[model samples]
Target: MPDDARDLDAEVRYAASPDVAWVEGPDRVALVDLRDPASATPQLCPEPAASLWRAVAEGPKGESQLVALANDVVGEQAEALVAAFLEALAGAGLVVAT
Candidate 1:
């Protein structure tokens, strides 16, 4: 894992970015960064990603809690799944460290 991933795993708490506009659909969730016009095009998230998004959106949650939540959705893949999701959300400015 990269240093950032390791640091995230070490106890970073995260929550959905206030700048993100969220819309939930029947099968997927759409996210757009209100602060970034380039991201006016929504990013549609499916399945586990949507689940993780909803969880973080509710409130700040630590890495372990997120991994456990992912475990409920993806079994043994929880750790990697969470890491990837967090990285993607952070990169997209859809999630922020709290």
Candidate 2:
């Protein structure tokens, strides 16, 4: 387990990549590649956006754990940013905590 994983409250599961991310009750998926923006169809965002979405889709993995993961996958200063991102996703009906 990682340092922050030690103190988490909610269940957590790892995905393959951020591109495969999708909200599913208390869990989320992630993909490796970002979807092409120019395509005239639905597109997936890249990390750290995808990573943040994964967190929200997956539900609270404990704020601390999220902060750590965000720092690692996104950036050290992105913990708060990712938290806010998750909030926005939740607001947009794109993510829901179980």
Candidate 3:
């Protein structure tokens, strides 16, 4: 996890990284980091990750909003799931805190 991941909270807002290029499929989403040509392979984002990705791509959202969006999918685990997702996204350079 990055230092920023430790700072995540209900009020922390996130948005998709400008360097990412994404394609949304019916079942999943694929992403490529344009900033790293050598590793710019498309990464598949499944399920809640895909949904969350789409949501953040639209605009910045706080941790609370993401948890709400993920609630239907993960139930009681929504908060932890969203937090883990945000941490991974931040570490992967796919999303940034704003």
Candidate 4:
């Protein structure tokens, strides 16, 4: 989902597709496919979410601006949700923090 197109909160709340992949068992971590409206999984769970974290860690944007961006479409819980999603990815070895 593009940030500019739809409200994150609204998208998560109403527009998200019903399909999500749970990749676990053989690996310690898991991969979840957050399907887009087009049904293509463009994000690789933690890696992309890690990129988001890198963006935050770099301090490129003020917390307010960043949080607003996180909240832009994701609402208040977006912060934690992104983190949990990333952690799940990391646990599966799909992504590693640099």
Per-residue lDDT of candidate 2, residues 23-57 (tens digit): 32323333223344344233354556666666544
lDDT, candidate 3, 6-91, per-residue tens: 55553668999999999988788989999988867888888877889999999998887899899978889899889888888889
lDDT of 4 at 79: 75
RMSD of each: 5.7, 9.2, 6.4, 13.6
Tens-place lDDT per residue, model 1, 1-98, is 99967875687799999998888987779888889687488789998789999999999888888998999999999999999998888877789998
Off by over 4 Å in 1: 1-10
lDDT: worst 10-residue window of model 3: 3-12
50 Cα displacement, candidate 3 (Å):
0.9
Clashes of each: 0, 8, 0, 4
Model 3, TM vs. native: 0.83
Q: Where does candidate 2 have its weakest 10-residue lDDT segment? A: 24-33
Give per-residue lDDT, candidate 1, residue 50: 91
- TM-score leader: 1
lDDT leader: 1
RMSD score of candidate 4 (Å): 13.6
The residue pairs in collision within model 4 are 8-73, 9-73, 29-91, 29-92
* Cα RMSD of predicted structure 2: 9.2
Q: Candidate 1: TM-score?
A: 0.84
Two-way TM-score contest, 2 vs 3, winner:
3
